[model samples]
Target: MSSSRYLTNQFLIAMPGLEDPNFFHSVTYICEHNDNGALGLVINRPLEMQLGEIFQHINIEHADPDIRQIQVHLGGPVQQDRGFVLHEPLGDWEATLKVTDRIGVTSSIDILQAIAINEGPERTLVALGYAGWGAGQLEQEMADNAWLSGPADPEILFRTPDAERWRAAAASLGIDLDLLSGEAGHA
Candidate 1:
């Protein structure tokens, strides 16, 4: 595959030995990639907070009794204060990016309100911040083996646990992350 190919709707699974704390053993869903740059959300790094905390912070009273059940992830290293929603059943929102036929990403308060009252998309993953790369940066990372690219699988995104997502995403590509050698050498 060409390193310069558009990666929208694909998954970027971080390889082992990635020392950067923000991306160590991470699985990011590429929402946009092109000549300009690339943007994605790290899908695994769950934070200590949940949707309830977010609603309260934004002055949106949440009625869902299971609000605490929701998870909030650390999307990436940039814009850490903003919220981003990766969801399904693409619906109209103040601002939304249809990442795929089954997935969408929203960065609007209206979507958050819908989620607060249980009227939001059925499958949702809320996150803060997002991973970003300047022009050609992502391709360079790919060439360096910092990440393995794969098709974005919603099952792995919504069904897998936070700590297991990285490995699970890699598994989808028939890769056992445990077996990857950290040393840069070919046998």
Candidate 2:
């Protein structure tokens, strides 16, 4: 098999006809890719939960309404209850995963508090879970045309509207999303 490391920290844009309900029109950001497998976060799927709701559930006082209004995203299918904050690189944290030079994922309360205080990283998207693929599963999926890979764009991930993320990511690769077909089989 080829090395998965090459795809690390890349964007995996779902093909036009992806049948999987979970990944249909999904825009996933590959956080770690290696021989073991790949892990990523679905950046485009936002859950109904809001940051304020989460703060209330966790008993964390959210004094500022702005912080509470931040949308909570659906990170992935696994560990749906867990939280993953994809944010701009700033401040210290307990467990932080640097997704790129401009983006980082923090799973600590400190980051949350910083966000509540409006003193956190300038760009951030709070997710409720993360996507995971077993060994070689992602590579196989990519080979099968289930996804298109491209470089990560902080603006696309954090700034672009969720409704347009799929097209934007594909456009970054010079792909016209409408031209893509769902059928994975090729001649």
Winning model by TM-score:
1
Segments in model 1 whose C-alpha atoms lie over 4 Å from true places:
1-4, 184-187
Question: How does model 1 score by TM-score?
Answer: 0.94
Q: For residues 6-117, what per-residue lDDT tens digits would candidate 1 score against the true structure? A: 8898889888877789898899999989888999999999999988888888899877669646989999999999999999978888899888777899999999888877
Displacement of the residue 148 alpha carbon in candidate 2, Å: 0.4
Residue 72, model 2: lDDT of: 93
Give the Cα lDDT of each candidate. 0.87, 0.85
Angstrom error of the Cα, residue 50, model 1: value is 0.9
Give the clashing residue pairs of candidate 2, or none.
none
Estimate candidate 1's alpha-carbon lDDT, on a 0 to 1 scale: 0.87
Tens-place lDDT digits, model 2, residues 1-187: 7654467778999887787998999999988887788788999998887899988887877788888989899999999888988887745688888766767788898888778878888889899889999988987897898888989888898999999999999888888888767874321
RMSD of each: 2.3, 2.3
